[model samples]
Target: MPALPTVRRLSLAGLALATTVAGVSMTASAKPPEPAELSAAAQVNRTIQGMSLEEKVGQLFVLFAYGPDAHQPDARNTTLYGVASPAEVVAKYKPGGWIYFDGRGNVQNPTQVATLSNQLQQAAIGTGLHVPLLIATDQEQGVVTRIGPPATQFGGSMALGAARSTADARTAAAITGRELKALGIRQDYAPDADVNINALNPVIGTRSYSSDPKLVSEMTAAQVQGFQRDAGITATAKHFPGHGDTVDDSHTALPTINHTLEQWNAIDAPPFKAAIKAGIDSIMTAHIVVPALDPSGDPATLSKPILTGVLRKQLGFRGVIVTDGLEMAAVRQEYGDAEAAVRAIEAGVDQLLLPPAPAVQFNAVLDAVRSGRISERRIDESLLRILLLKLKNGVFFEPYVDTAKAAEIGPAASLATAQKIVDKSITLIKDDTKTLPLSNTPRKILVTGWGVSTTQNLANSLAKRGAVTTVAQTGAAPSDAAIAGSVAKAADNDVTVLLTRKAWDSKVTDKLGKQRKLVNDLLATGKPVIVVAVQDPYDIAYYPAAPTFLATYGYAAVSMESLAKALYGEIKPTGKLPVDIPVAGEPQKPLYSFGHGMSW
Candidate 1:
């Protein structure tokens, strides 16, 4: 990556404030096309002019891989392409991009990641046209983060949204961009623009910034500016027109969202519009079916009316349209991998991300163009868009990044800012019994939870604040005997603090039921109990009658520290709920609505 000039290296928050006060006098949109853009456009036209049918089709397929390594001999090697070394796959197939996935088999340190990126770029350079690969990953931060340890870990979208400041959102995204750029990754499938109105939305719960469309729009726009302008990386606002309203995870099953165009316009479409106005690099297609857009019930990933008509014509987003992973059950169960890949391109998606079988899908798309099923002109159009994105980001000029900088940039500047975000996002939903501040007059405190570290952190913090603190990790969703023993143990303390974490998936409802019973048993003891939900805010809805409740939105280290402070009353709990937590059966009746918070 090209090193930015020191004069232009103002922190993202400072740049945001400066732009706000002075009225955004300088921006990529405001300035004329740089020499790089002009050169890239000419180069793309020239390259496209000379490409064969197969070579042009290759530019549309962006496959998934773990790291630089080949697939091990195991049952898990499911993809048809890239079973060998990634470099060999690139040399053979010549893909336009590569998507990195973590935790399966390939995990590397920061230097290793930088080296792998260099290897991948070199492989692309070896191929004809030398179009630098668009290397990307799910660097959405918080729990969904891919590259880490060396990379700075910030809170997710909901945590930033709780702060209710665009500047804060900008800063968080900019910092994330800086870290990603250092690692030689140019594209981030992040800043989820989904308006999480449904508390039961499994995949998008804490990933979404807020349920309020206006706030989601503003924060998403700020994040786009931060990632693009401040970090010089491409930002993709995803799961359009919105994936937040559905109760199902697209990875598991096809989810249907039955919103009229009026409702869609009001809630789901605004953030994407704001993202487009902020000049986002791309918009990823959701697999969910929206009956309002396409009555045929086609998922957005394969719906021409939705992608070409609504996103392209209505929203006017001309940058690029990328598809979510095609292997996901939402699309795979309905359509074959190769068939879906071809249809996705026909439906107006510029990039096909993470196909189940890359070679088969690539050949299917190639065959489509050759047989006139997909016109050569269509192939050329997508090729130009892909090449132009490469040029716009200067990936052609500086495909490899500084290994030393990759190791050094993220941590030194990000810790304090991350801590501050966590502090501002810890919401105190209720303290009705005045259980908070935990009675300063020297009392025994028992911190018990499913998470050992969370319980220990609270115990440690309380111990520092003059209370004798003890902790127990009552094995998450414990059995009746385990729950009974933990409850009996809790009776020894003057006050009991229960740390709870909830999953947004309906499958976990049974597990939450078990945890709820434990909470009920704790409360039945008649000892003052405070519930700290360190993850999903909806945990409060499951245990509404707890004496006091707090929501941290996540369990990042900073969140834990900030939560401890909030518990000890060292800092006031000022954070507000970014989403509504409705009653279990009734979606309209919220136990604690958005923006609800309390302090002692």
Candidate 2:
């Protein structure tokens, strides 16, 4: 989906749905009554003392709110998001919390999300002890946004890094948190503390703030303050001990970091340490195994030494420790969900995130306690931490959110702020020929790329600037004939602009190799070939010969529009490189430094 239309359409759909399903029921009047005057610890102790074994177990597991396979209009009957319905899952497992995921087809917009949260909370309130669910999601604004449309989307961590403004970081996070809070979400798994040092790292690419631990540390701390203090939402510093240095993605298989303790402390551990000192509410464990931290090669999620020893005792982190999804292969391949859950609790993780089989995991932990394998005191400790998070975020007294207000907030103020930040994040890698700030004179322009929508938007923007533009929406590295046809048409244009979207290529095939060849082929022509990297800035390493190169570090419509404005000298390019782009066969040496950027 195009970035602009995605937000606009999502907002409209969410508003319409909110009017139909939510209506006045989601107003401030729906906010739950304030709990009795008692300290958070006192209330948690009282609640825990009254809870049953099943209720306590339920509080430990955070399951996906909707079924994954539920394709029907009534998704509650599907088995993908665990059980038949949200109410059914709550009643059956008495889960401590639920997370919304769009990948499972259970999520649509902010309206449906708010309604679902309210419904899930109602079910949890009806259960024994009536503890509110710890509603959460990966609302990491940039690439990993769960709640779509209507929610004001920002340029994420790398963009913040390029903007290099702690004030902007805090403001962006605050906007994200405010929007999430409106949708009844209390916890944000964001401000990724991972310092992306390895260029080949797949998952943590733009999600990380910077390669510099100092920058990542300051930005993450600012993000936490924005989410917790400004938006009144619990902020979680994630993928702990750093998932940035390793090339392997934990989502697929277990990744191990062999860096020594000294290296880890210098590069990866500083951001997390800064987050802890910034008074972060939660810390999420990575699925990767750091051999330096734990010699057994166990994923940190399942390691007692890393979770309890390093994070708890060594770092002096006192907040809740959450595990990265237990369903991930990093943990699941070695130990099943049930065994993993038991071990994770034993590892001192306060919350089990997205266990595939919540009931089995719950039962396994329950049985472990019964068999004296896992003590009741341990469970109580986790429960206290969980309850403390809810209380700290005001989840108990104000779980229900004003959906109408939420619909108004994200789109109204966020888009403007996002545009400014994204504009600032537009990095000029190499403008040797000074082909940018294209003249206002009428000229033929050939705008072609596999990323169709963004290129199309760029074409339209160029047309408005008096350049007669033609678009060839080549889907994912066009064929030889297609490239020839595009080149033939480019012969008619004054300048050829090729937009490429590639962060990391698959191990199976060099997917971006074909695209790189196309750019080089286009450059072979006499016309100036301007390469705009919409996704990853590292693409310039492949086609450095391109006369002009720009890195937006994003492909959103706002980013594209900002690029267009910069091209016309309306918005001067100000963004710097957030990560080093290594040349071929030189992993340690970078063609461009971290702060490299130039403008006309």
Candidate 3:
């Protein structure tokens, strides 16, 4: 006697059996598949077999379109893609995935995002292969998070680094995944695996967990567990072969990673290795050139030696390999839109993200396959991985999210956990004058910073604690009048607190100089000047003579509240430095070592 599947059979001799497992179907001529054979691979393979060449090519690229409404066509979008709307785009290309960009109006709120996702799926279901698209967004949390308000804005990866708790990493990823699930988002291009060694790294500073490779690896692995295993959403570890050490932005131009093979193994390999071991669903390739990896001047996105030889063969990564934005200058300068797609596929990439003209690229790849420039077998290899991702992400069964439930599961749901992360992450860098804990009152406190609204909110937090506060939004490189006004307020107030936002990394002309003047001006007013760094703890390195200092990894709502609480001793500072704050004029010695923190 053999165990039979809990499925429906229509006839005895020639029954059509419908299985709950992966929606598998059994024909009358075929015997039931073994338990192992009944897994999603079989169904995914069947899906591949049924797809046409056009559908197959479409599945290889993750494209983007304009407008908040999926059904309503934007005039520019129609002329560009020749597709009336998102639904029209889906029906035309039969793409493998779609990326959500907030600035492009692809996402508005939970309900709107959910509607967009469902409409995209509806279009896919109505098309050739009827395969659900793998939806993705850069919800990296903290600084680079794509979805705003209503979405739980956890502190960035650097905050996670400061907390020094892998448990927090997992929990944060879980909470983020839950919210994304509510809105029908299935993939997160996050848990940036780049070991941010460059202090001047403009793009990945707050995004990378830490400068320490081991710390980054631990946090990366734990986040994978949180995102994929616990939260049930696909998590992609990105900018492969390390985008962390470069000072230049890959979006604008190509950056070179000048590490030797041994150095690369030490700095850049740990986090990606950890990600692979933890079973990350996808790995996004960088657009940077690593001379040691491939001396051919090819970025990782189109480097066979990097993507196929190193990541696939050396690292033994069997999951999907996705290219970072194809429209980015790093790749565009090297190859045209269509040629890059062909090159990426040949280089062993599974998904092409954000091609400028998706249709043009799609047709190019299709033509390549027909001309034997790319093989159909290569296409299936990538398609199989993507289909598995779809399976793991639950597109086969739970294709749509309950739009009503998404509102309840919005940012409010994760506020507690978010506040907890920031609370545990705020660090008291120094207190030269012992002016900390503000003595319960300070006649009046002036909270002046870059963002008018952000500083006002911090002031509001203080006022709630029975302290009178004034706020000034000193725009970057504050004018002489703004600085004089702040000094005058400092004279009126017992304590003047100045907030700095990445002042060290400012590209604005003499931004750091103006800030120093403002700080020294406030100090001259005979008030206990407290400098609070709202983001990028390194701001204190420039102001060594400051009376007091605090580091909140981000300026999110929770971070602001936590910063205020830490100032007045309402909460203890528990954060540690995740990266070194270099001593000015001495890059060799740091003003503060990694994990350095002074707690009360």
Q: Judging by TM-score against the true structure, name the best candidate.
A: 3
The residue pairs found clashing in candidate 1 are: 1-401
Across residues 1-600, which tens digit of lDDT does each residue of candidate 1 receive? 332211222232332233223232223333333443344434555677777887788788886554445322333443465455677677777888887777754447777677778777877877766677898888888768887665777768888888788998898889888888887889999879999998778888888989999999999999999999998888999998799898788999999998999999999999999999998878899999999999998899999999999998888876778899888999988778889998999999999988877778888998888789998877776776676676566575678887777778557569778777778888888888787765468888777776766678667777777888778777457678877876887789888888877733437643747778888999999988888877778888777678789888777666777887887777888888898888877899877788888876
Best-fitting candidate, scored by lDDT: 3
Q: How far is candidate 3 from the true structure (C-alpha RMSD, Å)?
A: 5.7
The residue-by-residue lDDT of candidate 3 on 230-319, one tens digit each, is 888889998899998887889898999999999999999999999999988799999999999999999899999999999988998877
lDDT, candidates in the order shown: 0.79, 0.78, 0.82
- Regions of candidate 1 where Cα sits further than 4 Å from its true position: 1-38, 67-79, 439-444, 452-469, 503-506, 509-512
- Which is the winner by TM-score between candidate 2 and candidate 3? 3
Please give the distance, in angstroms, between residue 454's alpha carbon in candidate 1 and its true position after superposition: 4.2
For each candidate, how many residue pairs have backbone atoms clashing (under 3 Å)?
1, 6, 2
What are the per-residue Cα lDDT tens digits for candidate 2 across 426-494?
888898887888778778889887577778878888877888899986655567887787888888889
Candidate 3 worst ten-residue window by lDDT: 9-18
**Against the true structure, what is each candidate's TM-score?**
0.90, 0.90, 0.92
